[model samples]
Target: MALSLWRSVFGGSTNAPEDGGVAFWSSPERAGWLTKQGEYIKTWRRRWFVLKHGKLFWFKNSVVTRASIPRGVIPVASCLTVKGAEDTLNRAFAFEISTRAETMYFIADSEKEKEEWINSIGRSIVQQSRCLADAEVVDYGSSEKR
Candidate 1:
């Protein structure tokens, strides 16, 4: 039973990355129901949002039973930022994620849910930025920052 639960959350064995890198982190930081703005129209649709690997993925239904093929994905890379959109949208439960290319707005079921998503995504963005900064090489030979 425990093993099955573990496999359902992560995977049994075939959950490795395509390039043979490390496997995806087993658990999601946050997963819940949220409404997403459509691309072409102003229509909003409900989806199961999963935050993993600094990316937000939407599923049609449950994350466990489904094959985890995301209907849509919002990559929260280091450059991305998450903020409340109550002022812009005039909705208490609204938040937006902006990247270099585009900005996506989402509405949570409640104010609490919205706050949780914002904090989780904000932490993810900070974590990604730290990873990027750590991977960068500091030039001691040059006169930059010392």
Candidate 2:
């Protein structure tokens, strides 16, 4: 079957945990399967991705136990942008997430999935950035109490 073939080729038995199996405490904001471009080889490899606690993590398999180790991780706070990159990659459902140092590309299953990922990641970036900013603000009332 096509599904089995996809699994064999991609190394993912199922979609990544949609209900947050990766983290111990809270559910992940989003999780799914995406084909990501290799860092140096220019090859594409299917990865199970999870977005949680302002971080994006990818694994080789969908089964994420407490001992599971992510193949890679991108802190959402460090990301500057998440946007469609179909034109740049010449591939459908392609998008890019970039920080100051690098841009990583991923291909979703469909246009809808692509947009969903972009929105989720974009929101995470904004939310995480805001949290950092909030932490830096001086609290005059707290200072007065001391």
Candidate 3:
């Protein structure tokens, strides 16, 4: 219940910043936050009343697919957003692609898999930039009010 509340306020887990670490929020939408757990977005699962932003949205994705990554160096590729890059305590914050129209997947596993994907024309995966391309930043100046 409380977990659901936090989710409502923060939009979704995918929108949270990874660098912040893991944090549980009562009002996750606020900026310049510093709480008991102000790092990665928490599920808010540890409280009562089910805060406005605490629910399924906080969990991001719940999909689990058969992946060869679990057997090799990267033992959880299908479950990762950027399997080959960083390893989060939970997988889903990275930049992963799973389109079905003309789909091809990349899992971080044995050296051969990584090498093959990199050397191949498609199915290539790499570390992604952390900045939003065209997003507007809310300046801290108090000169104007919206």
Candidate 4:
């Protein structure tokens, strides 16, 4: 009964890992607070960012409520890199995510937090690449093991 309620409310499978088994990130990788640029506009706003299922999600604030949906989401698999953007706008704790679609900029509270986000996102990209490589491998005819 409770499980069904959770699935119906969250719209995702209960058996799926809560954080999508992102082993590189922290146990609760939603600790980073960042300022994200609006998707379509030039305005920037503060948001609480979470990484899960090879994607990055942003909320209005740090406290995640069941009723509140994520304000924005970026697919980490499509992201090419996460690196420091100290040159951009002269912000020391700034980092950027370069995706196939667009580059997104964010400001972390400190240098340490900025590095953590970069490391986590970097790991996600590598993991996705490995998964894709494994899936692409095919034994044409000589499957000795099989």
Q: Number of clashes in every candidate structure?
A: 0, 0, 26, 0
Rank the models by lDDT, top first. Answer: 2, 4, 1, 3
lDDT: the better of candidates 1 and 2: 2
True-structure RMSD, every candidate: 8.6, 9.5, 17.5, 7.7
Instruction: List, residue by residue over 1-146, the lDDT tens digit for candidate 3.
Output: 22222333334432342212323233421111101111235432211111111111122222212210110011111212323322432222221223222112223334454433333212222211112222545666856776
lDDT (CA) for every model shown?
Answer: 0.68, 0.78, 0.24, 0.69
What tens-digit string does per-residue lDDT give for candidate 1 at 1-146?
Answer: 22232233335433322222212234778888988887668788898877777666666786443334455555566236798998988877999988665667889989899999999999989987888888996877887673
Candidate 3: TM-score? 0.18
Return the top candidate by TM-score. 2
Stretch of 10 with least lDDT, candidate 3: 68-77
The candidate that wins on lDDT is: 2
Report the C-alpha lDDT of model 4 over 1-146, residue by residue, as the tens digit.
32333343345555432433333134454456899766667687898887865667666777664444555556566778899998985877889998665778898888888988999989888988888899899887876764
Q: Scored by Cα lDDT, where does model 4 land? A: 0.69
Per-residue alpha-carbon lDDT of candidate 2 for residues 82-142, written as tens digits (9 for 90 to 100): 9999999999999999877688899999999999999999998999999999999987776
Q: How does candidate 2 score on lDDT?
A: 0.78
What is the TM-score of each predicted model, taking all chains together? 0.74, 0.78, 0.18, 0.73
- Cα shift from native, residue 70, model 3 (Å): 30
